[model samples]
Target: MIPASDQDLEQVQAQFQALVMPHLDRLLGFASRRTRSVAEAEDAVQEACVRAWLGFAGLRDPAKVRPWLYCILRAVLADNCERDGRRQRLVSITRLEDEHEALVGGDDDAVLVEVEGRLTGEVIRAALADIPEDFATAVEMHDIDGFKYQEIADILGIPIGTVMSRISRGRRLLAGAVASNQRAWLRDDGKGERQAEARRAARAGGFDGGVTS
Candidate 1:
């Protein structure tokens, strides 16, 4: 790549700071969901930003910047996974038994009430952590970040069809994980309190679904 002029570099830097910084929280959340480690996610995003800055001159379309940056991030994450050789582990809601126990505080009803809000966040996080990185990234970009399908496609350097497939499959996997966990939690006679707590937690987590009966 040709070296960008100083002015051009400055412009690119400014653009990145303005357009990209606001999305750091969302991106970090995406990374955390995929990597299951907040530190790793932060590292991945920082590396992506560095790569973007270094490659800014090669970017021809300013309008495509968001997708382009995301693409860089995706690539960085893939490289990390490959280097680590960590198999993507499927997270099961049933696996949250220990956490659930901790939240529930040992009493049937009180445990349910105590755990309601905390369980939702933990369950959501675990559910998200279980998906494959590619699918998870797509879901994070399209569903969580609210990027359009076309934009997500561009960001990941994949076709829109692939984006749709990843999102569909990822959601299915996440839903299954959540359902499995919820079922396990409800197996006790204290389900009423648990559901009530789940609803309150969902609201606190900013989930529109609120609570389910």
Candidate 2:
């Protein structure tokens, strides 16, 4: 294929930045939650953005920017997994059942109320980390990143029903993880107090709903 002129490349870069740059933090958060290491997440984001930039001239709709970038990121993640031989360890959807079922009992909506009341960015990250990767991906894309179900389905390359199921199951898992006092991750000395302060600050900064668990 013939390369675009420098002027065309410049316009593509400008448009790509305008649309994609705004979502970079969220995308990084997405990658960070999925990957085991910070370096891996950063590498995934870098590769995905490079691929995005290379294909920017073909992107026709500004509104589709977020999903397009996510699609690229997912591909990068899959590639990374394959390269690292982690793909063989991927558990099927059926394996999520036990964890899904563990989310039962105890006043979920009440737990959700407590979670929302004291939600901080750190707490959200922790909760996301506690869930299955697939479920967390769906939840973060739909709830945290504010993508529609259809967009999430497109980005995840799954049926819309599957996306909805994942979001529902993922939200339950997040709520359980956040509300449980027995969680080992929440046991750090005085960390809960710090997280509470962060929550208040987040509210003051207009993060009202706070992850919609």
Off by over 4 Å in 2: 1-4, 87-116, 180-213
Best by TM-score: 2
Q: Per-residue lDDT of 84-166 in model 1, one digit per residue for the tens? A: 66444333333333344443454466545533544454455545544445666677677667899989887777899998988
| Best-matching candidate per lDDT | 2
- What clash pairs does model 1 have? 104-111
lDDT of 2 by residue, 1-213 (tens): 545787777786787788988988888887765666567689899999999988887788888888899899989978876676552222223333444444444456564455466556767766554455678788888888889999988888889999999999887676665655324334557565455444433322334332232
lDDT of the candidates, in the order given = 0.63, 0.68
Residue 113 lDDT in model 2? Answer: 55
lDDT, model 1, position 83: 82
**Candidate 2, after superposition: displacement of residue 26 in Å?**
1.1
